[model samples]
Target: MSLPYFHHTPETASNFAQNLRENSVEYVRFELPDLAGLSRGKTVPMNHVESYTLNGLNLYGGAVTLDSASIPIQGTGYNEDINFADCLMVPDPDTVSNVPWLANTARVICDTKWYDGRPQPAAPRTVLKNILSLAAQMGYGVKMGHEYEFYVVDAATRKPLYTGQPIFVTSLLHQHPALDKLMRVLNLSGVDMITANGEYGPSQWELNFAAMDGIAAADRAFVFKNTVKEFLHTEGLLATFMTKPYKGLAGSCSHFHISLYELASGRNVFLDAADKDGMSPIMKQFTAGILEHAAAAQAIWNPTPNCYRRIRPHTFAPSNVSWGVEDRSASVRIKASKDKRQHLEVRVPSALSNPYLTAAATIAAGLLGMQHESVLAPERSGLKEADDSFKKLPTEMHESLAALEADTDFIHMLGSEFVHVFQTVKTAEILRLREDIPAAETNEYFDLY
Candidate 1:
């Protein structure tokens, strides 16, 4: 009843639980986001919700450190030798939403914490919470909108459900009944959709989300990924949020739109009437921060052996750490709008990246820039092909890991334990892939990225 930062007041929680009971909710899924952007949690009877909510559900620490494939990577402290320790997965009452796809079930996202009530430092949600706390200390409240692009394809052949569809075109969606069903379930789950469209790739579809604040946004993103996969698999279809599911396909990028508000005045700090594109001096500094830390953050933003395939020149995903007004090519893109509705659209994170970790990394860079009054360099508008003229980011997963390792201060800021867990797990995967690369044709990426 008295949890800090995870948000539910006792009055509201009791009311919600009462409603769940009256609604005859049979099962409650207590979900947690893992390192590889996958949900790892257990479901309990609704009768146990009160008990778990009060005492906290005991779950393994490796649940947070496991690789995309659920393989216990060699140095994460979650493997056989140094078995995972028990951590508390305390459900946040505020995150409870009906599981529309499941029978009589309701899902709630949780916050991982130590037995002593301190946040589980390495958990993705915990990392985001820490970054949000830091932003609060800086007197900024973040409002973020996340965009996801995914592919729906035939289960056997792995060919697209629809091919050669133009971007933003919805006509092709009619060919995929599974996708049409997914839209209904998403609405039933109370996840708001801003737009849905067929993207540049064959069978690739993009979904944009309405802006939400802090952990709410993270929760929505986590749910969105799982929900899509669940619905597709149930419909006997394969859906992938992988950055690039195929070699020749144009990659799917997950873009995060960020806007900061002054806590006291309730003003959007990124908005300035005097500045062009409404990017204020503060916003400029934040952009500079993201540009400065782009290389290091790529480990968290892209974070896969296959992610490199999408970060090349001419790909919509960023290849350089540059910002531009109305330029889709730059990593930090300022939209073509001058109104107060302006926000920064970060174009680096891959569709497969852990949303919480990605958001934490992004906020960390921006806050660092604000703290130091970092200055933005000249905008690289319309010169995306001039890759040599821009600051390039790491192209390989190992190089990204090295960049992350070299960024000691940021690693410390995001928590050394988290970085260690991430690095060890990724290192093991990199090694494994080098010896025997996984089939690039499989669509089982949710658990086998």
Candidate 2:
């Protein structure tokens, strides 16, 4: 297949407009990443693409400053109210694709920034960029793939009726006619979907995408979520990425498989055939770093309260900070590959986590390990049976926040100002969750997701 055209400058946007107009494109979807690491955007007429390309589009400043509930925290002192901050959404031309579900509809992922040219601190894309810079300085390039799981429900009835059983089943319970339509839309939108299968939860489905660099991978994730929601809503179905949508069912997770490559020779640096475990010394250090900082990084990987429910033990969910080969029970599982292409799959992250932040934190933590020459012990074969001797991830949101607060090393890596702002906003979310409902009801409601 031909590579999708990517536009990096205003001139490219102008030229792309000609092609879009020639193809009878009616609408251009402006996709932006929000603070919660979700995709939110507007669709404009194709004719207006040039104007937005030249001057950039205006978005509410609250997009980056608000919490998951869209509430503005006054303590952060970023924005006074739910006021729209003037920011520029620059279309990433390379990310443009046509939407097949809607005739003449096209989509483009964008980068958000302040009008003065500074990046929004809470921007997931920018966060990934910062981590990538750190990785580059360490003489390695990070490549990652995302395995996203979610559920689709009837929008009108809000009933989970798609995949019938509470776990992966042979037959789909109520296959909506819109499923095919959504798939077509994603295909046309240039999302490289490897497979879509029933997940271990009611109405839950998982989608896998080809791995790419940090920024590109995160961009694809944002686009994929946006396309799913937009296309499903048009078909009267609601698509949710909420971490644990249903109780008693397997919670949806967004698993990431990360690997590092040599910058100069473009060689996969993680592979070592002579080593009994097939991981190089550098690879061990990287894994050590991730394990060491896994607790502190929970705020970025498992950001929400509901996310905690997915980290329990003996359910294929990772509760301990351990690494093993092909062991699904561990937080970090080393996957077997032919060569340097081998990498570690981090299994503990929830679907609700911000892709940019999660990817950034993983890269930063791994780089830290490399800097310290940390060594990961021999890979354990059976992580499920491993006792509590292994460090476990925080089981509650508040605990995770406290862990983040205590880990000065990881906090320093994320930068003081950004970490402070993130902590304040997240603390407010936990409090809101407490006030919104009783603990039991909250757990039940989230479990039914």
For lDDT, the strongest prediction is 1
Global Cα RMSD, each model: 4.3, 4.4
Put down candidate 1 lDDT per residue, 1-449, tens digits, no spaces: 12333644566556656778998899999899889878889999977777677667899867888877788776665556456677788788777877887899999888887667777677888888888988998888998977989888877888877667577776776776777788878877768876778889988888776889887898898889889888888887888988877877788878988888998987888888887667899899999999888899999999997888999887777898788887788888886466657789999899998888888999998998999899998675466646677868899999999999998768867989889888998998888778873564455564566
Question: Candidate 1, overall lDDT?
Answer: 0.82
What tens-digit string does per-residue lDDT give for candidate 2 at 1-449? 01111224767767878778988999998877776866677898977988887667788765665788788787664666324457778777677787777788888777776777766666666667777877787787888988888888889888876544545453572365666666667767777877767777777878677888757888777778777887888888898998887778778888988998888998889988988767888888999999999998887889888899888888777998888888888888888674767899998888888777888888888888989999887765555536677877889988888988998888777766567778889999888888876678778898798
lDDT of 1 at 372: 87
lDDT of 1 at 297: 97
Candidate 2: worst-modelled 10 consecutive residues by lDDT = 1-10
Show model 1 residue runs off by greater than 4 Å.
1-16, 77-82, 437-449
